[model samples]
Target: MGKREHCRTSVLFFPTFVNRFGCGKAQCTGVPSFRIGHAGFLDRLVWPDLNRRLSVAKETIVNRSNRAGQIAELRKVVMWLYDKGRYHDALPGAVQLVDWSRDSHGSSYPELADSINILAMTYHALGQYDAAEPLHVEALELRRRCNGERSCAVAMSMNNLAALHFDCGKFGKSEELYLRSLEIDRNAQTLHNLGVLYHAMGRFAEAKPLFHEALEIRHEAPGENSSSFALTLNCLAALYFRMSDYAQAESLWRRALKIRGRVSGRRHPDYARTLNNLGAVYYILGELARAERFFMRALRIRRQVFGDIHGECAQTLDNLGSVSRAKGRFKKAL
Candidate 1:
């Protein structure tokens, strides 16, 4: 219905033995990306942290010849930052996009709803649930009002809001919105997120099929990116890990790790996530040395990229502590 991007950064990474991926179009592009952007969008994809992507976005803005073009470029920048897990940087751009959309198209415009959805998800990614919820609610209401309840736009909004609810531990609300979304479209993002919710709630039996369904949809998607496919693998591995099926979890995580390493690289948070997950699995299997090695690697990456103030940091630290405790390194654990 509109040309808004689908910033898939709303996928809450599970604070468990695994990570989760995103929902919606390939991110702010109106295609289901599940938190992936065009990984090859830039030349050779240089990165310590996708610096090349940022540089190109800046260069593109300089080249755009009109207000519309600039706005379009800015939206891409916001979505890229969000997809790459750069929420702190994405926030200002997301807010600016919302304001620009509203100024150009008014409060009730479909474009504005999309911008609002992106901003709400920025907050969602930051773990600012209180700030995120109302914006998510507003986006859903605006989209439903502007486009009605049965469209893809509405379904996308439902997925966004449901993800927020999942993070907030509002299982009933999350499930309600996800089911409503699936009723409109059995898209990959919603299926993956709904499955994640079921996994978090300990409904392993229900979550498994949904994860499989989501994976199949992703497999069938044309030109599917490794990030999304890896995430589905990651979260499904998480489910198996929760079920004490370490062998299954390890196999899935290994697949995800390979894909993420190839696409997102070792320094990327997605790669760090699989490292942390593997650590947890090894810990459970009494491979203390292996668990400690993986935990250390993941912790280093999180600390370098996200600093000390994010859930990624917290989760990795907790894992490290467990490793130290297991190894009788009490001071290190502390």
Candidate 2:
């Protein structure tokens, strides 16, 4: 008889026959019969058949567990590299994470989206917008798929894409995405970004309220001394400087500088930015010596953080040259 027929016959008649004959170690011709409805019967009849299936299930569980641990470790390393500004070093790991998440089940869509977003952000930091844009688009679509259209995740993706477009000088597209993100979620970062976009467009009146709103939200959530709050303070100060409100600009810049100093110290790039902005304010106020000092400090910090060839260092050099010329030292300016 065929194997299928033999298996079907055994299943259909074995239990009744064993029970009726009370076959507990009973000998039937040359074969030992198994007792029905007992552990012995299951072990005797099914162990060989089920052992291979059980082993496969066990191996699958172990592999999944190992993959999950690997993903967790990758996330930690990727985030650490990003925080340290090691974008190039982080890129391979971020790409690996994306590939792994994509190969995972549909339940891992959120992980896939996160990996895509991080990879896009790393590309953006490297100024490779061509590579970054499609990744951001894919991340947004994945987030929308995993977490509905109006979710905070979707809103964050929208905000990131908007920032990318803004950097690319696609103002209209950026503004549209920013507005859509704000409509979905009243996030402090989104508010600040939209305000910055408005400020860039010279819409001072529109930008002011948004900046204030963002500041208030950040202050309430992360508190006034938070880096995010200091960032908004610096942005608003920049707007004030552009508007020629020197005193107000000086005050805000000073506060931001103090906060940054307390949080990140003098060697930080953020502290250098505040120093540069403060120097600009002093330059406008005609305090040439004070302006020169701030500019020098900013230049020193920028050189330390980004070396000599950075745009920030060049800008600080120009500011110093302006200070020298303003003090009637034309030779020094040159």
Candidate 3:
């Protein structure tokens, strides 16, 4: 019953939100135009009115589509606000939709399930683990009742709940749930997550085969440069590094870095982690020059992305300092 803490910064910028006018200006301009910002003015006037209408619609609405549309629009707005790091503003609207979906249409089980999932995720994001847990449990129960436990939808619910367990440090419970979910994935991504769980638990022997299996599946079913694939490669690289297989580790780290860069930008934390891992491989290989370069690059990127006091940046700095000291650059190390 643990909710994920809401520490994630908003991925969306309020200034870049697309207006209802459907101009798609945000997508086209790469920056929101004045017209989009002006739309906030409309919210001031319409939001109160919409809330009144939405409340009435939920109770006595004869029109299904209109009620659905109103709730959907509110959900979208809540999601947008959440993405913008405006959790306080987003929560009430999200809760409103949860109530609406639960009560408005008696036959809309699927919609209700989806809304519950969203509510659960939102609560998780806010660190309300106690609140999030029951919501996820409810959704899982509904999915299982509607579509057998082996169904992909149920697998997703189990995986999500397992992740929540992992985040909450319930490793034994997480392992049990993950194993159940793994039986249902029949796909590389799920296996990859299982591999990561194994790696986290220091079960390198178990993790390695799973990573290789995921890689093979991805090789056969290639498409977009998926973060999941990159993560699999990175986990394998880390496991290899732990085993002192520097050559294989370095190769996988570079490949993971390339995929992460292509998909999530070079400045992303995933790339920083890859860079750090690659540097560790070089450090062990006694290739001090290459190690220093990668470590420094990683340090800089982590600092820029997460700031100097962040744990990731601190780790990178410590690594760079250790490497410098080993190379007899004591002054530089300091």
Q: What is the C-alpha RMSD of each candidate to the true structure, in Å?
A: 5.1, 26.0, 12.7
Q: On residues 175-221, what C-alpha lDDT tens digit does candidate 1 reach at each position? A: 99889877877766777787888777777788899888767766755
Residues 140-184, candidate 2: write the lDDT tens digits.
898788889987678777877887787676879989998997787
Name model 1 segments beyond 4 Å from true.
1-10, 18-65, 222-225
Clashing pairs in 3: 1-129, 2-129, 3-128, 3-129, 4-124, 5-127, 6-125
Judging by lDDT against the true structure, name the best candidate. Answer: 1
Global lDDT scores for all candidate models: 0.69, 0.62, 0.57
State in Å the error of residue 10, model 3: 17
Q: Best to worst by TM-score, what's the order?
A: 1, 2, 3
Model 3 residue 223 CA deviation (Å) reads: 3.4
- Please give the lDDT score at residue 79 for candidate 3: 54
Full-model lDDT, candidate 3: 0.57
TM-score of each: 0.84, 0.72, 0.61
Candidate 3 lDDT over residue span 1-334, tens digit each: 1111111111110000001100011000000111111112011122436455545544534455667777766665665444332444556777777788887755336566656766765665444669878987887787787667786657656765765675565878877876886676555544555665676677878878877876776554443265445666676776776676778877887887788787556765556667777777777778889988988888787666555665556667777787888899999889
